[model samples]
Target: MMKHQIARVLVLVSIAGTCLSTASCQKTDPNRKETIPVCGEVYVDGQPAAMLQIQCHPVEGMDTQQPTITQAVTDQEGKFQLATYEAGDGAPVGEYKLTFVWQNFSAVAASYSGPDKLKKRYADPGKSPFPLRVEKGKQVDLGRIELSTK
Candidate 1:
């Protein structure tokens, strides 16, 4: 009958629409799920260093610099976390120069000794320098810093 034909046509159209919708929803690629973290950590000479505490410069000769990334201080186990940016997080993605400066001082020498030379000379911290390259959005695990007494 004419009524039966019309009902069958309507049902077929609905099924087709449903199938198309489902297919479109299922077409998302697995690769699109990649994302970046908002933070991370750093290490120096096998000791966990504070994030953003170690200054990082993106380039040289630009005459510009960035702030230390805020990071948790290393725990007793020497563990830390680094900064992260979400996928498409609009953060600058590239290379950086990680700089660590040890500015040790002699409090007793500074107070008592008029001549700084006679005081015992240890790692000045002012002289201890650590520099490295870091790739953004990549894990930079600095295993150790082998320093020389010389």
Candidate 2:
């Protein structure tokens, strides 16, 4: 009887351990909203614009009080993928105004800083010329956005 009881306790402890491990392994957040994939490219003077910062600002009629602003940095190929909650997870469905800012990289500071390469022309969402609409269950490909230094 003593041996049987010990075995039962061991099994119960193992089951409890498994349950805790499974619950802890899950990274999903209950409050996390659904997101759709968004991708695009940037061009300046008909050339690929690399290392530019792109932001999606929620416009009117959307949740601006606690808005989830999606953002991305252009790769060397000038490609970008908007991420809000996680890397490459995309943004929630809404109407957004796009903003772009290209800052010079400072090796001394070990970060990208300094004045805007675009001269803050695309820094304000209110004055942003690019208006984007993200639909439910639909992927948004903005194609190529052309800019000019002139």
**Candidate 1: regions farther than 4 A off:** 1-52, 60-72, 84-92, 101-137, 146-150
lDDT of 1 by residue, 15-132 (tens): 9999999999988555332223223343444444421123334444222343323222233343433342332222233444444333333456642223322132322323334333
Please give the lDDT score at residue 99 for candidate 2.
Answer: 95
lDDT of each: 0.40, 0.89
Top model number, lDDT: 2
Candidate 1, position 92, lDDT = 37
Score residue 104 of candidate 2 by CA lDDT: 90
C-alpha-based local distance difference test score of model 1: 0.40
* Total backbone collisions for each predicted model: 15, 0
> Over the stretch 1-150, how does candidate 2's per-residue lDDT look in tens digits?
999999999999999999999988896876677999999999988999988999988887457455576899898889999999988888888889999999997667867888898999999999999998989999999999998877
Off by over 4 Å in 2: 1-5, 24-27, 61-66, 107-110
